[model samples]
Target: MQKNSSSIKSSTDILKQAIQFIGQHNITAIPINYTVSYEYCRGHHVLLRQAIDQAIVNKQPITNEAIQGWFDAFLLGYDLSELNKSHLDLNNIVDQLASTTTQAEEDVNQYDTSLKECKDELNETLDTSSLSSIVSSLLTSTTAMQIAMEQMKQQITASQCEIASLQDRLALVTIEAVTDPLTGLANRKGLSMAINESLSTALQSKNYPCLLLLDIDYFKKINDSFGHLVGDKAIKILADTLKKQLKGKDTAARYGGEEFAILLPETDLQNAWKVGENIRRVVESLRITRSNNHEEVFRMTISIGIARYQANQSINDLIELADNALYQSKNTGRNRVTIFETKL
Candidate 1:
């Protein structure tokens, strides 16, 4: 997931182009549509660009469904259909190898029988013609066995290489499925997987685990004032800051939109509060300058809510508690931390 960068003016220009494209096509200005159009304008995804270009050249109507299809096929890690096709191909290769191996085994058995016959013939009293025929038969059997073995070897080698390639692609697809393209953080699905694993381990080890939900204060205002590109930069900044502040064992994710979630293993409520407070202060101190006008600098703040896991608690319940505390923080002030207290 390499991020694409451009100057502020250039980004704004691209944004305008994207909007114009969407308008011309009579497509709705949804987030996905905007994203695909922006990427097309940037020419980042070659296949995506080509699809759009071809549609335009052929006078095909650009529809939302078409854009979404392209996004899923190209922008996303890999297409599900393509993945299934790869699996079918892998199965076919395996089947071919199996057949080849069976053929080779049969060839070896046949060659052995030929040798036995030749031995029996040699054991008997035979003339020059009889001996010559036996020798020729042996040569033919040996050659056929050699050719079968060679074919098997080549098939095995080819299959091995193909399987390795498929494995690599599957690994990449798995990563991309869980990763957020914009901030390079774990997406919600990844976060949930991490939570499940942590919860299972914590339940066994009796270790404390805490979840923190953070939301950028006035995030929509930032988007409205500067634009979505700048807003995206802000989110990336927060994500990077979280990565720096947290330990390797902790899991950080872009929960959704301007909100983020952090899972801390072996951490109690008190320690979680400290972590949340530290992040709040650090983000408050950050100065984000407008890319177009450096003189116009602004600061961003985040509100965090924390909830520690309890015995027999579900993941959804824990997240809800954290969300409640987050609502408390938002209601109290724009930037603060709140810890959820369970009523005994």
Candidate 2:
């Protein structure tokens, strides 16, 4: 009976399709930005596709912010899929290697038993011709064993090279999956991973982890006045500023458009507040200049909200607290830090 087969396009083909989709839409940003978006819509990503479609249906002028927001959501899903595939591939490779090694061992044992039988026959044979025949059989068996060993060694070497290549690809795919191409910072998926790990560690009787939510003040105005390219530059500058202020084990992530998240591991409320203040001050001190004219300088400020992790609380709970505090900062005034205080 003929076996039924299914064919699928390779990654290259998918990438080509993505490029074509981008051209059809007349998107002028970097190719990766739209390529991922294309994959998102093609894969029937419900939430992201609907988000874009809803904007169009409502006759909304689709801004870069909307596209980027939806695309970031798509990236989070892509990162998770890539991570799961990498793990599954590694597990399969390990299992196959184990099975191959076991078979090789069994073959060696069979060869050893055959050689022993040949030796016994040689000892029992009294005639010169019979003894010569036994010796010839032994030589043939030994030659076959040597060839088998060489082949096994070659197979093992090939497997090792294949494993190394897979490892390299996994690493590269993982980095790309969890990184924001614009700011070169961890995306939402990466931030979630970091938070989970830190939370797990913190639950083991260590210090609590603190979440800081930061937002760029007047970001919409900046985008509206300066064009999307300049807006992108401003976001990059803010990302850079955040990176400079964080110390060891402190992670900063691009949470969303004009919003950033910081995780301070093993930090208390006071220290977390201090870090938030420091970041705000550092950001306020920055002055970005337009490439076209050095005379044009753009100044920006940020509002931060901090909330230390509480025992038996979920990450979403912590985020809610920090978000509330962040809103308080916005309400009170811009360029300030607010801490979420729990009621006893």
Candidate 3:
């Protein structure tokens, strides 16, 4: 009881200190910022603490973007302890199955030996009493064998169910690992995997894929004007618009804060530009209302850059080309699509 009380007190103290730190730094009290601050106050995450301290020493403002980056880099993903426990449970189930099978095999062998002895006894001259005893022994052996077989069958069925359940749990974990909690879209890791697979398929089919890198224009301004919550809502809106415009084979992912990536399989430069334009138009048309007041509304837009994959080009190279095109769109004007060209 004393230990529990101490833990509660420590947690409360950390929360208080985190709130104070946020107030001192003028940081937004968003969930991510609060979590990072709390962890920093706890002093258990050494790397996170070091990063925070380094930022302070450098006199850099701890912005929401920086906090989110830290959270993604350090605190994201499923817990390792839970994953380890799942693996251990699976192993135990497998061992139990193996032991059950071994027992069943031993029972079968014993039953086989009993049948052999009964057969040998039948071959010898025997009285009625002897024959009766032999028959009874055979019946008992057969009954035991049938029971063992049934037990083995039931055990195997149970093991299969356990294996199926574990597979389902692991599948869910895999999806969660690659998914962004906010937008219901793929995260950076998922995007990376999709890019690799698309590139590989393109290589085999001799058809190239197109990559699009998109960024919300002046996202920080939106965050500052409205708030992080509204900023997130705009992101979700953009994500939904992108999803609506994509083909079945296309992969869309949240690349990072306020940035999104789309991989278009077997798409040429012209079609990729058209897709980008459609998305840009859709995003530009969206007017989000502030949650606090229905009378207040704001608009957002996205800039897109497109690049077609070339033979023998790495994933990074393709992304760089797309990013360059995206930069051109951002530089000349916002809410436009730019295609990568050698001249640019």
Which of the numbered candidates is closest to the native, going by highest TM-score? 2
1 or 3, greater by lDDT = 3
Per-residue lDDT of 48 in model 3: 93
Clashing pairs in 3: none
Best by lDDT: 3
How do the residues 139-200 of candidate 1 rate in per-residue lDDT, one tens digit apiece?
89888888888888997997788667656654655566678888889998789889988988
Per-model TM-score on C-alpha atoms: 0.72, 0.73, 0.68
CA shift of 71, model 1, Å: 12
| Global local distance difference test of model 1 | 0.82
In model 1, state the lDDT of residue 73.
84
Better lDDT candidate (1, 2): 1
**Deviation in Å, model 2, residue 138 alpha carbon:** 2.4
Tens digits of per-residue lDDT for model 3, 46-110: 99999999999999999989998888888886233333444555566676678789999999899
* Residue-level lDDT tens digits of model 2 in 1-344: 01211111233234345546555555544423554545554666777667767876897755566666766666554435534544454555555556567767887898889888987886777788888887788788778878877877876786677567657655665676678889998888778889999988889976889999999998899889988888898899889888888889888999999999999999999999999998888888888788877656578899999999888888899999999999999999889999999989
